[model samples]
Target chain A: MSFLAAASTNINPGLKAMGYGLSAIGPGIGVGIVFGQGVNAIARQPELTSTIRTNMLLGFAFSEALALIGLVAPFIYTS
Target chain B: MSFLAAASTNINPGLKAMGYGLSAIGPGIGVGIVFGQGVNAIARQPELTSTIRTNMLLGFAFSEALALIGLVAPFIYTS
Candidate 1:
């Protein structure tokens, strides 16, 4: 692990970026599942499609926000 | 944000931890939606409650696993 550290007693830029990259993966899959299931719910109830669609968008936005945050995290904390 | 740190730093642990923290948010909400909507599905059709409940648990488990991976990421790439 130290081999990747690159500098003694200091932080690493590449490692920080890699961390953000790792972070995006979970939220990416998570958003997919949320929307996919929401759509399935709507499909099962066409009459309730509007309600389901509203909630689906809400869930999707929330899930996507996490990924967006991950995208920005490295810039926020890296020094 | 860079103003919070001194000049010429090699890397930042804060960035990596923040990255992982951001990653967990999506899956957290995702699992919540999976079960929440699943419960609604069961309510709509009581006869299928058992089947819906089983699938709900399975989806929740998978979403939780993603958050778990994000939780471990900072430790993995901290080098």
Candidate 2:
């Protein structure tokens, strides 16, 4: 039991950054999808490229907001 | 053993934010998927732009709601 306790003790509890990292993953993927699909749409209809780009930027902003929120959540929830 | 205990005591048990972070991921990706597809659909049929945009916004709201819930979850689950 002492050995187990000693091993566990070595683990750090500064996992707030880990939480931010985890939250960033989803938004990262989300932003990627928005741009990827936007590019595909532009390619299919070059005339609509501007419109597709506008939509992609809007989507990126919305999705990226979540990751930013994650960054702030730890500070907000001190418990 | 005393040294080990002392070291462990310095570590925090604040993993609530981590749970919220994990929960945000799915919805973030969901919102991305909705917008990505919506843009692609609009490219295919520009005439349906309004309809697609409406659907996309609605879907985004639904998906984003999940992330918002995650933000509040840490407070609700204090254990």
Candidate 3:
């Protein structure tokens, strides 16, 4: 039990950064999909390009904000 | 050996929450993109607006739920 405890006790400061890094993967894919699909839609219908573009930006903003919050969470909770 | 062991014992609970927070970032961005582009698609193809809108809502809800899951992970795991 002592051996197990000691093994588990080893701290890794990088673990937090690693977690944050892993979290970024999904958002990256999501953002890519949003824009990729939006562009395809716009290409097919140029008339509504502005509207599409506007909504795309808004979506990107909200999602991106969540990521930003995640980035800050460590610091926020620490305080 | 003792010095190394001594350095290893410190653990931060924040590390886990930081992990959960990190997990949220991707889904957040994902939901944003899904909805944003869906709106754009709807604006362009007004006829298919309902279909696109529904799908977007579904996607957003799913991704948002994932983010919520991440939000709760630390509480569940640490306990």
Which candidate has the highest DockQ of all? 2
Instruction: Give TM per candidate.
Output: 0.54, 0.83, 0.67
Task: Compose the digit string of candidate 2's lDDT tens values, residues A1-79.
Answer: 2433443342234677888888999999999999999899999999998899889998999999999998887777654
Clash pairs, model 3 backbone: A27-B26
How well is each residue in A1-79 modelled by candidate 3, as lDDT tens digits? 1333344544445655665665666667667777877788787778888877776775676566556656655553331
On the 0 to 100 scale, the lDDT of residue B73 in model 2 is 75
> Rank by TM-score, descending?
2, 3, 1
Separately for all candidates shown, the number of backbone clashes (residues 3 or more apart, or on different chains) is: 3, 0, 1
Cα lDDT of model 1 by residue, B1-79, tens digit? 2324324554456566555765576575676577547635844774685787678667766876675576556666644
lDDT of 3 by residue, B1-79 (tens): 2334423543454576466666776686678567756866686677886688678768877877877677556656543
**Proportion of native contacts in model 1?**
0.19
Task: Write model 2 residue lDDT over B12-76, tens digit each, in one string.
Answer: 32476677689879877888899899899999999999999998999999999999988887677
After superposition on all CA atoms, what RMSD does each candidate show versus the true structure? 9.0, 4.7, 5.5
Write model 1 residue lDDT over A1-79, tens digit each, in one string: 1223332454555666666666666566766676667667666766766655655565566556556666665555433
Winner by TM-score: 2
Winner by TM-score between candidate 3 and candidate 1: 3
